[model samples]
Target: MQDTPSFYYQGVAALARSIQVSDKNSKFVLYMNRADYLDDFKFKKTGVNIEILQSEYYISDVEEPESFPGSLYTLDVIKKIAQAESLDEYIILDPDCLVIGEIDSRFLERHGCNIGFYKLIEGADYQFNKFPFERYGKDINLIGGEVIMINTQGAKEICQAIGSITDRRGLLTEEHYLTVIANQGKIRYCHINTEVKRIWTRMSYRNCADRDYLYKIIHLPAEKKKGIPRLFDKIDFINSHDDLIESIRYFTWLKESVLLDSISKIYRWTKNFRGRA
Candidate 1:
């Protein structure tokens, strides 16, 4: 709605890349604003059954949480998916996220336990966002909304929780709601800190953890425009995860300096132009 969903193309690239790394039985759903979002997508893999989901906005009255930075009606989207699909396992990934290795299996189990989330356990003050642990209480773990995993039973529970809780905190995010749930001892989780790490962008590299090349999924929130497009463009062609790791390692290579930005952009433009041929 707002700004035509800037990351829509990333969704296209994300779907294709996920398909590239996943197995035959590992099906996918590419949720977007329109059915033809992929019309401009350059790469097409054979036998990839990508189901496009264009769900009606779940909350008719509540506009997207505008005050919260980078926040959408993410809970609403997850709710829509939960109600629509009937997968044995349910995982919600943001467009900025990329699959690591064989995700289907690692995603299924959380520290050898089923029906748990891949949690980024944050402290009272994590990065710069000092969590309101007072509101949710202490000793309860908080996780990021980038990558989430839950079973059918857990998804069902979260679906119901969203309907009632999503509209409660106007300035708060769904990530906060996840914290509330954990504080209430509603769900189980795992220390998947290594499995899914948010790659620190130039804007927020100070908060970034030590880079782990073997992560199950790389969640790039702020590093989208510079890295995701180039990395994803490669996936349109046949590539192994090994081919992507080097690119992932140097995600901010394009933004090293003013001159490098220009050169990288030109190189990407040329690559795009040649691909158009």
Candidate 2:
């Protein structure tokens, strides 16, 4: 099988570990504003063909103009750099995500969809109050920027559009900006299962399962009250091998083959009870 093309931020050792365990052949491209901080890492040894690109988007964590000249600008630059890279498709994962296990590359293939993202919780809102409707001018639900997989054409389009926007006050965050443009064009978009949506607030895995679909990805924050990672933090909820594989297979496109049945059935049975009341 061919390797999946992926990207991550600097200092995301945990995410890198997950990626390595998922598939030894996957290639990862990391972005950093300062190359010196990540010079010590060896991507090839870790099962990832690492490419450290210069980041135009970075800050001392949260030091900035509150919103402007921070992640927005940084992500814009990253998008541009990503566009310049050559790859069949690329998944941009935040530094805080945990891969649990390898994902079937077919799911990430561009099915005529320019972008792949998951919907937010039904009632709660974080980035845009109006959500996809407000940002995209349509009534579709909103998606997060945490785990984004884009085709090369989509990458270049998003990069150029984001680069053209010079003001921040009037616009939402970078994620919203990218989705908004895609929406305007009615870009062929794909919706991941609700299981992949962020489970930060009162949302739980059981709650997600109630929707009858699984999420191959979930977005959690970095900061938190009383040690709980925020929706943007690099922490994860999956803690075992089965959890990893099952999570990756949620709403999966890969056929359930011999490899899947080979995993412990005990874990599969137990998964039903997990995240449940």
Candidate 3:
């Protein structure tokens, strides 16, 4: 399962294509803000079992300084989908991720815990230690949210905990809450030495395959680069194996041009107007 905003349609296509080539038996579900933004014509012939679910926008009355509105609600959406569909377990992936190789389901099965997630590599501090370390002690490991395997029951507990939070001072974002849970030994943390790896920071594309074990899934977080050309190059490199990346590159280039952006916006507006009429 993956959650994607409409602006990252190309990433969705790349993810779908990667699954089609690598893990054909696995089900691929996409959760998006707007369902209509998906162009069915592009994926109808691909034989990929893709399901698109429209997630409800979460509106919070409380003024949050650190977290964005509807940001923390993603977990709620995942929990609702799992319960409504009677799913035993589901892997939640960010839209910008690609499955380059086969993901072994047996590796993700949990015995005692309800949740599984990737822990940051040992001895590699990425400066995510803003939480109160005194509460969790110094031996706690920080987990990444880019890819999470959740059990419906445990997720419900996490959601309840999130709802009970009145003070948002120490906890900055959803990742922090998840880390806290992992620190308490509430969740199972997957190691980086396995087939799953995360690229937290921006790095050269050539270094992606330099790891000891071949990574099955690659999580690319959204990072803002200085120049348009450099950013496009990085996007192209990370998604080098997928042809769908070209579309993303083209759309990005279009967004960089003022005239193209204006024209594209007008076209979308007119199309929406015609549909209403």
Candidate 4:
């Protein structure tokens, strides 16, 4: 490890702002490919160590030719942070994720073995979900890409293993990279059980929950609250916080950015056209 111990998140200035609050001590680095955008983030006043990753690092070798710029950029940053920190272990958290409570370090202590992750799509659903999940000529264990904890060794192995598959024509995703390495016996993945209330955080889009409104402004209809359990009210209470709102925005941008971006593009593309149907 050559650099200071740090946490890494790539993308907008908004994400860095959210991360600054949740992970106050760890260094934060933002990897922006666009220089103009890079200048915009200069005054975000992100308290942690903030540096923009160079774009050249995102290029894939011949083997992984189809690398998506975004995924490759993230991978490049992860490798850079892991190597720079020489950290025994480090976390890669989605900026949109709000830390309601402290993480379970003990959960990560079970390191050499698989660490916690959400389940991937089942084989039966592969035909429908494969376009999103299957990558790099291998089946991906559908896990949340937002938060990952890795020891120095695990990080090193993941970095090296991913580098070998230069042809990303199939596996152009960060989560699938983990899946590919794990299936190859190069690494083990711990499956995080969603039933356990606090072992992990949930992705709203995956669960079909509405994901707008600033975290500080969840306006539950008073009528709807009547039949709801006290627990439900509690859930709403926590969700209505400024800090949490910022964090969720940060995490959601990177995790759902592609989906959101695609939707925006489609909407824009169709705006000028008339539909006969």
Candidate 5:
């Protein structure tokens, strides 16, 4: 993890560890506003290279770009990357994701697929309630903005749709435009559910009973604040020893989630009490 807790560094750390753990070859291009920000983050991978692309815009946060550079400019950044690299296909992942299994394997490639989008909750409609999704919006499930697999052509079409959007009914989010574009069917897309999951640790909102090991990549969006840092430490310990146990990821996820959620609740409650007192 980096010196500051404000920015989530767990996903980056996990990505670094994934390089060491995997048998197959893998490389990464991390998009960030400042490259020097990762100087303190010690990556232990030897053969695989992780390239950092200095970003023109901060697209980490969707709702709050002023407070934190959100994902409003995500489409533009991805489109630029695809063009610059002349890539046939690429994966766009969030900072809150962890790769548990295979990612870069040749078998994983979608030959004809334009955009391969992962949906966390299968069959659940209107994931982002605020945004009025253009078509098939109510019927279609959420397309997570976390893990996106796109080719250059697909990237251009998505970006065009995003730019053409006049209806900013809700907040500006990548997923909103994705939902709209997905319905158009102009670009071929696959809604992948099992391999990628956006898990909520809170009991009420939890998507699954446990963090299933079958998932190749897990999107822990809730853990950015507290759970991720703790999980990051656990991953560091496991990776340093070359254990690379898959089940550890699940166990650590459950334990940290409960503890951190409690801490967050207490802190919020205490702050509210102090305000009253």
Candidate 6:
């Protein structure tokens, strides 16, 4: 995630909650672009081991004007950090994601590939067109970037290959870059079996099971700003490991709020129904 301080608190809360439910052996690291932000940040008391790294490496020199400068630096920063620690493998997650169930390491280990990413059937074209793939003689796949597992050695090779592209037309978006690299036979697809779902709107909460253990990852990218508090409330309620009454109350209120908004839109549309027609 980018260094958006406004969402830091919520991001940490979600991270802590994720740690609580994740595999006992799994390690976590949070990379922040700013160093001073660490002074005021406080992690929740989840007892799960987590490390914080302030990233100094950047891709500003290679970034395209239209793209956010920080976008391309994520993988670079991860590679640097992994190399520093001599880590063989690591998983990268967007801070807005919540781990609602145990992440079986075996799932990643069984692949025995250099990189692992979610494979989406429908969204390939958006990433495919962004790269000069003809130069690399590789096709594209829709590799979801929200969460990825990286084999350190393969990442180094891919990063080196990407860095050598001198005739680049534009900055390679991270997902597309990974897709290109993976299509070169260096990537493995993690088939999570519907365990991961993206929440784009208030309606998404309705799909969340009352039981946290049912889903592996609940990605809340759209809800990073205003929705975190309500989500924190829901997660806090759920983490108590009690009955669902409190969470139901919050969800009920949320559902009604969405319904009311929909009704208001309908009413306004009807009130002006004849004006444009």
Instruction: Output the number of the TM-score-best candidate.
Output: 5
TM-score each candidate. 0.68, 0.59, 0.61, 0.53, 0.71, 0.67
* Candidate 1 local lDDT, residue 46: 30
lDDT of 4 by residue, 142-241 (tens): 5445566666656666778777866554555576666666666665656544311111112222211333331211212111212112222223232323
Considering lDDT, which of the candidate structures 3 and 5 is the better prediction for this target?
5
Q: After aligning candidate 2 to the native by TM-score, how far in Å is the CA of 186 from where it should be?
A: 6.3
1-277, model 3: which lDDT tens digit per residue? Answer: 1343333454555566666656766777765455564553254433434454444435343665544455555665555654654445666776566666767665546345556667765432335435556665767767776677665665776666555555455565456677876666544545533656754332211112334124777665533222222333344344334443343343223123445445656766787799999
Task: Choose 4 or 5, whichever is better by lDDT.
Answer: 5
Report residue 119 deviation for candidate 4 (angstroms): 3.7
Candidate 2 matches the true fold with a TM-score of 0.59
Off by over 4 Å in 6: 1-3, 44-63, 81-89, 121-139, 184-195, 202-213, 232-277
In the order shown, the candidates' Cα RMSDs to the true structure are 9.6, 10.9, 12.6, 11.4, 6.2, 6.1
Question: Over the stretch 123-172, how does candidate 6's per-residue lDDT look in tens digits?
Answer: 32343335554665443555666777666665676667556555545445
Q: Per-residue CA lDDT of candidate 1, range 65-153, in tens?
A: 33453354566566665565554665667777777666655555535543455465452125444457565556656667777776555
Candidate 6 clashing pairs?
A: none
User: Model 2: how large is the Cα RMSD against the reference?
Assistant: 10.9
| Cα lDDT listed for each candidate | 0.56, 0.48, 0.53, 0.44, 0.58, 0.55
List model 2 lDDT by residue over 1-277, tens digit each.
0111122332254455456555555666565444454445444443444445454544433453344334454365446645565656667776545554455565646355656666565543443333435433556545566677666666666666666656533343565665565555545567755325554322111122323224444443421121122211322443444544454344222223433344434444576578483
